[model samples]
Target: MSVDEEQQPSVIEELTDVHFKFEVKEVLLELTRQADQENTLLALSVSQLGAEGKMRTYDLTITSYLRKVGLDYCEIRDSNNQPLHLISSSDKHGSDLLKVEYTKADINGPNFQTTFDNTEQNLKVELSSLDFLLHTKALLSTINYLNTAVPQELTASKDREAKKQVEKAGQGKTVSKGPTNSNVFTFKLSAELGSFRVEVCDDRRNIADITIQGIDGSVLVQAKETMVFARLRDIVVLDVDPKTIHKKAVSMVGEEVFSFQMSLYPNATEGEGYSDTSKVDGKVTMRLGCIQIVYLHKFLMSLLTFLDNFQTAKEALTVATAHAAEKAASSVRDFAQKSFRLSMDVKLKAPLIVVPQSSTSHNAFVVDLGLITVGNSFSLMSAEGFSLPVVLDTMDVKLTQLKLSRTTLKQGSPQTDIEILQPINLEFLVKRNLASSWYNKIPGVEVQGMLKSMNMALGQEDFGVLMKTLRENIGEGSKEHVLDVNKQVARDKAEQHQLEGNEVGCLPVEAGGGGGGGQPAAVTNAGGLGENIVNMLLNLEIKEVVVKLKKSRSDQKESPFLVLHVAQLGIHTNVRQYDMVATTYIKKISMKCLEFSGRWL
Candidate 1:
């Protein structure tokens, strides 16, 4: 005998009793897009198990479009007392590997085959058969094998005693033994796709496990189906408007149906198959709660209703373009100043020759000397002894040659005992050494010519005289003659002053403070010698001037006659001379007094 039977007491007892009944509440299937054309593996599981005993097995057959597509036969029941299990099958391969397993007492045998003959005629069919002739025989064989070597009468008596004890315990007390229970179910279904396993467990009161997986055993969806029982006394029904219900229903199924049609046909646009209500009903019924279903439905419907509202899109595009432009402008401006400086070479750090002069010095140099900026046009100094603002205008500057000129003068004795003068010119060339190699080979002859022209235009005669004197005085060969002439002119002037008895003395005078003084002569003009000479010259006006000539014996020629002219009291005097005397006066008085005297004074 088995351990359980051996341990059984002569007087048996039952623990407790509970009853359960399940009814067809509702069925819902939600499909987002469409079933794959290659067929998909789907699995449904009893997420929860409630009853203590093993659930009775049944056949499941699904039919659509007048075509049968399900397992030949399948039986699925809870294996453990838990309230959840899984059931799965594929739709790719034709249904052939489907099988059913059940309690021997609940079926004709340990396994049963499902036939699709009835499913071919009905689009939907659920068959729950209770024939257990073969199952009962198997259960009896197991019981008998376990309870061996016991008298029939004793077995009957013990069974009755056990029943009595179970009844007595239930009256007021607890019992040690409990009834045998089963609550979990695992099975496999065969479909056009492939075979899939299903597991069910009963852990909670009324929840079932439902899972779908692919042929390669990839999990797709997992769901928990909960069965809620409401007593008639406690049930509350809410009255909803028919219009509201219809609107909610339409909203709930719009996208789902559209997406389904789109998946079925690659060319389908949005809202395809929208008029098909069956697709909408299929998804709407799957919502666990009415409120969620309604909300989703309304949202989908609103999305379609206002899909043409493109004003916001236009505004968004405008704002994006504006932002892009702003960014581009900022980027350009960031380097604008630097780029300008580089291309123009006008920035502060560019190569510069800053000849910074003090205000006073610059003003004096530019204004007093009539100097101008050689290359740059802007003034560095103003006449008011202020630094002039500088502005950059161009970049080309050529350094040219600079030239200097100098002159010197000397005195000579003439026939009237007056002095004659000779002048010398001096020139110095200053050439610029430019850094550029190109300038080294080019002679600056044009530049030198320009300088010479400018000097002549400024003051040719004065410059020539001054330059001639400077050259004679400082030239390499005639330095001694220049010095001696200058000394003789000074001595002659001194002697002339002495002959006139002009002694010079200075005395301070009340005047502005710059060298304010008075001078006195060496001798007063008591004899008026200078005045007498001036009067004698002024009184000499003849009606007809005559010229006389003398011959010099050594020259073997007779000199021509010479006459003199003088201006007296605004009356002009004219004189004529011929021969040597005329030549002598022209060379002596005319040249010396007119040219030399004016320059010297």
Candidate 2:
């Protein structure tokens, strides 16, 4: 079983018996616009908050659409086999709609189970092809409405103050503002740590004030009038307390909220001149119950058989886009319904590892992480249309121990910069070094310029050819089946290995097949671009390596954790396939080192 699957039962047991129901219907909303020719359709001239306290109305229409287009009736139940909640359309919409139900079973014994039942067909297929642009516009419009929907007097005063601040800054004057001063735009949130508020002002400085207050309304944490800057062009703010967030969330929604972080970028359209492209980089932590996740996993596993059908549906939608979209929307209102059944079996594990030496002895590295968790910071640059690529200026990964536990890795004494751009358009540059230890002065390495899109990094045509080759060679099977085959192959090869032992033994043949000539099956099948791709992907280069033994507390010589240090390490892969299903490709890898001593095992 996968690691997640093994821990699924305990994760479910942590949940208390509870149910949830959600029903979405048509909501009529009124919106005001700047009274102009371009926005004159069905618009109302209502006073709104604007710069300089001006009452400017635009000619914009008030449009309303169903929020969740295809949802009908939904229901959920808890572990005690009792109904949690049921949500259905109102009497005005009538009775012919989708209905769904879920049953959560106890995880005490092997017989425990869970189930999901739905009566409709093609619901998910149609939902996948929705036009997200329209939905996004609607959501944004709603938020804008909410932000401006305040008392006219309050809005006017705030707008006038903001205008004065902007005018003063334009004249190169610093108008001092207090930390508690309210701005034109202010947002408040009740979180676990405390009640936090952020005030954004309209000025050249683009500074913001962040304050946290206790339950009694006393200030707890405050970052007053702070200018926002980041390594990534986008400015992101996160407000979350992992330890107490669950408790706070339960009081709000009555459910076990999972770990999550929120990111808000203020100036998304700062750099784009006229390009109509704005990037909103957000990290939303979904509060999906662990019990629900376990059952969802099982349901998805069951749907593997319908992969071909889904592909066919996608192609059909592509051919008749409008017709398929309309049909899918109608099906949700008239046919499909929600249905579910669930059961779970959770396994337990003890935390501590009994043998310390055994834990670190056999592996090259214990942990490997990149920009994923460095200072909780991220950089996001926008791309035109639907393509948003990620570019990492510098990437680093540390190995806990090299050859032995006693030795440590360190950086070089003198730092030297290196840049390598390959003939195939692959590039690498190392500019800095690693850290040193108290025992000695060491050398380090650094590499820069890590940016590429999955398909664009390797030309799309070349990537398609590579994927075709891989799919042909590996064939097709469920994930579990493929893993089983790999394990069996490793076992067979290990048993038949004879190079070191010098024992002559017959080579293993393809599974369920008779022995052929001495040629290996893999070589015979992997022809054409297969061999070239493997060779190109495996190429690695390293600069400068030093290995030394250090004395230990036991009064004897022992191997250090850092066995070798490379002044520079470079890896260039013309085409690296990181994902099989999504077919993601990465182009380059490079980095710098510590200041003291650095080495590898």
Cα lDDT of all candidates, in order? 0.23, 0.26
lDDT of 2 by residue, 1-601 (tens): 9999999976665444432333333432323445243231122111111111111121111111222222111112234653221111223243222222212222232322222111111111001111111121133233334434444566448646754654454344333432343221122212122223332221111112323222211111111222211111111122122221111111112233223233433333234511322233222222222110111111122234223223433443343443334333333332212111011111111111111111112111111111121112223333233232222222232211111111111235442311111111122443221111110111222333332211111223323433543343223224534554466457548755533452211111111122342234334433344212111122234443333323243555332332233343445433321221112232333232322455212
Worst 10 residues of 1 by lDDT: 338-347
Candidate 1, residues 1-601, lDDT tens digits: the string is 8888876642232221333333222233321212255321222222121212232332222221211122111122234543111222233333322222222222222223233221111121222111111121122223333233244466447545754654454344332222122121122222222222222211111111112222211111101111111111111111122222212111111112110100111111114332221221111111111111111222222233223222333444454454334333333321211001000111111111111111111110001111111221111111132122111122222222222222221125321211111111212222222211112122211111111111111123333443543343224224433444466467558756543632111111111111212121112212234211110011111122212222234466433223222221122222211111111111122111222334421
Best by TM-score: 2
Candidate 2 wrongly placed segments (more than 4 Å): 1-258, 262-301, 313-372, 375-392, 397-571, 575-601
For candidate 2, give the lDDT of residue 138. Answer: 31
Query: What global local distance difference test value does model 2 have?
Result: 0.26
